[model samples]
Target: MKKLILVRHAKTEQLYDYSKSDFDRKLLPRGHKDAATIANQLKNKEIIPDLFITSKAKRAKQTAEIYAETLGYNPSAIKKEQFIYDGYTTSEMIKYLSQFNSGSDTIIIFGHNPDIAGFTVNLISDDLWHFPTSCTTVINFNIDSWKDIEVRSGKVELYIYPKMFK
Candidate 1:
C-alpha cells in the first residue's frame, strides 16, 4: 500500500505585476504563516512523508521547503519538477510519482490548482470539490505499486485545510 498526500501551494500575492513572470511570484505574508501552520499540524499528527515532490514555481517550492524543514525531511531529497508546473495533469502527476520505487511508502506533492484538486477528485470518490491553498489531502492506495493506482481506487484518509486550524 502507498499513501499519497496532495498539497496545494499556499496563497500567493494577489497583485499582478505585469513585468514579473508568474513562475517567479512569491507567497504572500499570510501564505508563509499558513504554510507553517499546516507543516506544524502535520508534524503534530506525525504525518511525515518519505518523498517530497513539488513544482518548480517559487510559491510551491517555498511551501515544500517549509514542510521539509518542519518535518525534518532532507532538503536534498525534495524534487523540483518542471512537469508539475507545465503539464499540470493527473497523468503528469502519476507519471512523476511512478518514477519512485517501493522503498518510499509515503509521498507528498505540492502544486497549484485546479490540477491538484482535479487529481484528488480523480483518485477518490469523496466530495473533495475544492483544494484551497495550503490544503493537504491524504489518500491511501491499496495497490502495491504506484503504476497500479487506478482512478477512484484511493481511500480518502484525511483532508487538512489551513482554515480548519484558524
Candidate 2:
C-alpha cells in the first residue's frame, strides 16, 4: 500500500493587481500561521512523506516548505513543477503523479483547487466534503505500483484542516 497526501495551499492574500490571476498571489499572514499549524499537526501525526511535490507558485511552494521543515526532511527533496503553476486540471495532476517511480512509498502533492478537490473526490472512494485552504486528505491505495493506481480505488485514511488543531 502507498499513501498519497493531497494538500491545498494555505489561504492567500487579496489580489491588489490584476496583472496575474489569484494563483500568483502570496499567502496572507493568517495563511502562514495556519500552514505552520498544519505542518506541526502532520508531524504529530507522524504523517511524513518520502517525496514532496508542489506547485511553482509562491503560496504553494511556501506551504510545502513549511511541511518539509517541520517534518525534518531536507527541503531539497521537494520538487517544484511548472505544470502545476496555474490552470492545471485534475487529470494533468494525476498524469504527472503517475510518472513518479515506484520507489517512493509516500508522496505529498501541494496544489490548487478545484482540481485538488476534484481529484480527492474522484480518485478516492471515501466521501470528501471539500478541500478548503490548508486542508489535507490522506488516501491509501492497495496497489503493487504507482502505475497501478486506478480511479476511485483509494480509501481516505485522514482529512485534516488547520482549524481542527485549535
Candidate 3:
C-alpha cells in the first residue's frame, strides 16, 4: 500500500507589488501559526513521512519548513521540486508521483491550491472544492507501486486543516 499526504501552503501575503512575482511572496504570520497547528496535529497522530516534497515557491517552501520543524523532521531534507511550480496541473502531479515508486512508501507533498486540490480530486473524487490554506489530506492507495495509482484509485484516510480546529 502507498500513503500520500497532500498539503496546501499556508496563507500567503496578498501583496500588490507589481515588481514581485507570486512565486516570491512570503507567508503571513497567521500562515506560520496555522502550519504549526496542522503539523502538530499530524505529529500527535504519529504520521511520520518517509519523504517530504514541496513546490519551489517561496510560501510553499516556508510552510513546508514550518511543518518540518513542528514535526521534528529535518528541514534541509525537504525537496524543493522545481517542476511543481505555481501553474502545475493535476495530470502533472500524477506523473510526478510515478517517479517515487520504489523508495518511499509514505510521502508528504506541499503545494499550491487548485493544483493540489485538483490532484486530490482526480485521485479519489473527494469533492474538494475549497482546499484551504495549511490543509492536509491523506490518501491511501491499495496499489503497491505509485505508478499503479489511477484515477479514483485511492481512499481518503484523513482530512485536516487549521480552521478545522478553530
**Which 10-residue window of candidate 1 scores lowest in summed lDDT?**
87-96
lDDT of 1 at 132: 90
* Model 1 collision count: 0
TM-score of each: 0.94, 0.91, 0.94
Clashing pairs in 1: none
**In model 1, which runs have C-alpha deviations exceeding 4 angstroms?**
none
lDDT of 2 by residue, 76-123 (tens): 889988776665765666677778766788899888887778888888
TM-score ranking of the models: 1, 3, 2
- Clash-forming residue pairs, model 3: none
C-alpha RMSD by candidate, in order: 1.2, 1.7, 1.3
Best by the TM-score measure: 1
